[model samples]
Target: MIDFEIPADVAELRDRVRKFVDTEIVPYEKDSRVTAHGPTDELRRELIAKAKAAGLLSVQQRPEGMSHLEQAVIFEAAGWSTLGPVAMNCAAPDEGNMFLLSKVADADQAAEYLDPVVAGTTRSVFAMTEPDGAGSDPSQLSTTAVRDGGTFVINGRKWLITGAVGADTWIIMADVPGEGATLFLCHGDTPGIVIERVMNTMDRNYVEGHCVVRFEDLTLPESSVLGSVGQAFRYAQLRLAPARLTHCMRWLGAASRAQSIAIEHAKTRTSFGKPIGRHQGVGFLLAENEIALQQCRLMIWWACWHLDKGAKARHESSMVKAMVSEELFKVADRCVQVLGGIGISDETPVAAIFTDMRAFRLYDGPTEVHKYAISRQLLRDAAE
Candidate 1:
């Protein structure tokens, strides 16, 4: 049996987060301090404090617990505003990192890294995408971790690493000689780790900027390795499966908000004979937005249900990621079109949402990559 209903308890939590976002976080969307690189530490702390006071911070880690399905609900609410995830302590890199650490890190490591992040006091990054190397393709990883006695020396350049500028810790992916790929934990300020530049990007809500970083002979003790050596791909799969669905959950929120804004504009704003929404062209767009939003939500929940059941849901996650990323973008696009000029302008968040949603397709995993993985699995099943 399959159930799509939100339990009463989870609905209450979702409502709480929704109210907090509407009351506390949405107003900060226009703060000049909320830069392209995201909110400053002071601003972030201020908002996080408010969220904490409201009992919404780290809602995913509540003692009562949150299943992946429940997380999809609360996270969707948090995604209503671009800052909602950050304010609620459920935003990416950190959200994904916390999940990774809890599953893989030792107690000491968790206290050192995950605790602060879960507490909303620190930030972290997963360093995998690199320039001229492993972007969507993990096999092309060029970063090397050379074992020297008890320590390993890491050397490589990683680019477009989100939250790299102000991160306290990094989960670095590097290739070990004859060991495939491995994960390493290191402080952001580790000697020889350099931030070459913060890439100026389309969206600026990531807190730390998308960065180009160089790990020039950075060293870490053997104890710093996360999980087993040469298991980076497996660990990443574990992280990515849920992370990808969460991305859909959050972006779908953004898309839903955009659609709401467009609906409002259509209802009140005037046109030739009546409200612009009366026009078939505009009405159909809003209709499409609603249909797409519901579909995206269902896809996310379906994948999350599988995950909660202890399935990796590799193919399901891939399909949802590829579909929702592209579908949500369509939803955002329709919202923008329905708004006309204001949609593209910064006067509204639709433009920003549209821009962010565009990048959503490329991150996590590209659409083409997911399709390839899905087809490969199908081929294997057929052969079997």
Candidate 2:
């Protein structure tokens, strides 16, 4: 049986995270360096230092470890501010990569690659999506890694790779011809690897802007393989389900923040006569936002509970990701509408939250893809 109850330990951690975000991170939201394009490297380091001092810098798990459900609470609090997750060293590409490494990386690999990440000293990118190829579909992956004696030569163009700028490590997915898909770990500064460009995206809260990158005859030793060759999709699955749900958790916090700001505006700003929140039309939006937020949280907990029980949560996560991303976007959009012109203005983070939530629907597998996958699973199960 699934329990949605929050344990005492997890509740304490969530409070701690909320306090830290409110006290430490929110003040920096308006800093010039915390640009529309996200926090600059210098600002990132400063915030990370504070998080490190507070003992919240572990990227993957606490020393005591956390169930996925506990992680959901921590991640949500971290999402209170656009920078909170990064500050706590639990932001994506890195967070998901850390989870993947912990599951698959051998001892030496973990020491060399994962240690710096967990220490908040380095960031990594997942290079899987390609320009004309693997975006939502991995079977169309065009990147290739060909073995030659003891080393493999890789060539591919990858787009929409997060954290490519100044990232020191990478998890590259490529087709290995007869061996099927495979994963390669290589240094960002390795020869023949190039960052083509960082796309100027609508939401700039991503520390490293989404980027286009290329590998031109990049070579790696046999030891660079992340796990068993031909298991790239299997390894990726381990990261995808949990990572998808975590995105929901963090974004739920962001949407809730937007809702709270809107509520305050409605309470203080007078409409025709007195506070606008007195009007049913205006008040219903706030009411709906609350309902949606709670629903998203419940969906996240359900999926996370399955993961904590050592079950693959692929279908459950798909449902949560599609529903939460779309619903959270609604919550954010309603906040923008309720606040009027000021809400769309960058003067407040609500405008940015709306844009960020829109992108959330696209990444981690787009909404349509998840729905299709879920439907297929249901039909297949019924047939069985």
Candidate 3:
């Protein structure tokens, strides 16, 4: 039988994260420091300081000891406020970068590039998506890193690079002529790396927003290579599977927050004779939201359980990410509808959550891509 119980320690930590998010982070929702692009580095630093003081800074940094299932619980709590993940330093790009670094970085690289980020002392960017046909398909990667005597010179453009504006570290993906694609870890201010501009995106939960970057003969020593050459695609799967699952976990929390707000609005707002929640239309939506949230939680836990057991969980994670992203978007949309006019306005974060939820459906390999992958796996199993 599958045990549905959360261990006492994990449950306690979850409550702590929930309390911290609600009390410490939510107030910053209206902070002017949160710009149209995204929260600034100064704002991020201030928030990270709060989480550090609260003793919540480094839990996710130590990926080796932490349980993936437990991470789902903590990440969901941190995700309650969009800024909650930011405050706790479990936000994406950095969190995923930590995972990749933990898997591949040697001692020297970890010390200079990864440790400070894990400490929440610095922000990092992952440069994988390109302006051309490479967003969803990494094979379409056109970035080149040519061997120049002792150092490799990289030249390419990467866009939609999250947290690039004021980041301290970077994980760059480029193709070596004969060795295939590889990951290169470099300092943010490394010569030849440029932050072209911040891209205005629908979502604003990220620290520096999405950015366009160009590598103009960015050169790094052979030691800059993460793991062995020609192994990045393999390592990327290692990073993406778990990272994708965590996305679902965090967004699940955001959608839950939106649902709570909608339910409360339904409880107090009057329609014909009584509270609108009494109306079947509004009440049904709340019921649907409850059911969808539970589904999302279960899917997340199931996938995470596999990862905790040392399962690759690639297929499971794809299924979970695809299903949860779509379902949570529906939950957020329904919540907005239930709130009516107030939903469209910034009166509550429901609207913002709705917007982010839509974007989530597209990121982490869009729902269609995941569905395609799932189908391909099933077909392969049948053919075998």
Candidate 4:
């Protein structure tokens, strides 16, 4: 039996995060300068300090005996704040990157890269998704990392990289000599490492800035290798499962906010004599959205709980990603519809939430890809 009840301490943490979001983040959403790429360097630093002061940073690294379900509740609460995830230093791809490094990095490696990240002293980017290929297919990775006398030289271009614009370091994916795939940690200033440009995404609240980066001949010491050589592909797969679930958790919060807005509008805005909410059409759509959100929440919690038990959660995670992405988008789209023209305007967050939900469908392995993966698993199970 699965227990979804969050413990008292975890519940308190969730309240703390929600309070921080209301006080610190909600006010800044309307600021013209805080675009989708997220807050500026100074703003991010300030927010990180504030979040740390509130004991919100690294909330995922629970005590030795804490449950994964507890962590998921806390994460979802942090997601409630528009900038809580990033502010608390628990947002992706950093969250996922940090988790992967902590699992595989040795003492020195952890000190140099992972520790600083957990401390929120620096930002990192995962150079995995490529342009024409390798987005969903790990085997299609085309970047190359050749071993030199005492270093590894990397050459390739990585696109749609979140936090690439101001990343202090990178966990780059590349093909290792004689190995199928590998991960290398390289500093941003390493020679031949170049950030081509920050891509303008629909959602502008992400920090560090998303960009397309080009590495001509970036060189790093052998110490840069993360985990066993050639096992990078396996590590990547491991990281994505939890990371995608986290996205669902956070986006679920955003969708809830949108729903709240729509509900408020429905109650106050009247048409033809009474509140539009009285109309069966608008009321039914709102009902469907509420149902979908609850269902998505349960799926995400299940996946997180499974992970806490040290289970692979391959099939479960894929299902949650596929289902949650679709459901969240529906909620966002309904919010836009309920609000009418005002919903599409920058006057409210509904428009931005809609755009974000669309992009969510693309990132962390698209819905189509997850469906294919889940279907193949079912077939294999049946055959067995």
| Model 3 C-alpha lDDT per residue in residues 85-172, reported as the tens digit of each score | 9999999988999988988999999999989998888999889999896777899989999999999999999999998987888899
Assess each prediction's global lDDT (C-alpha) against the native: 0.90, 0.89, 0.91, 0.84
lDDT of 2 by residue, 259-304 (tens): 9899999999997988999999989999999999999999998898
What TM-score does each of the candidates earn? 0.98, 0.98, 0.99, 0.96
Candidate 4 lDDT tens digits, 1-384? 756677788888778887888788777677655765766766777778988888777777644543557656767777765577878888877888987887888998888888888888888889987897777997888889998899888888889899876677689999986876999887777778788888887766578568898889888888898887898889998888888888888888889889999999999999999999999999998999999999998998888778977998989999999999999999999999999999999778889889878988887889999999999999999999
For model 2, what is the alpha-carbon lDDT of residue 132? Answer: 92
Predicted structure with the largest TM-score when compared to the true one: 3
Model 1 scores a TM of 0.98
Off by over 4 Å in 1: none
Report per-prediction Cα RMSD to one decimal. 1.0, 1.2, 1.0, 1.5
Best lDDT among the predictions, by candidate number: 3
- Write out the backbone clash pairs for model 3: none
Clashing pairs in 2: none
Total clashes in model 1, counting residue pairs 3 or more apart in sequence or in different chains: 1
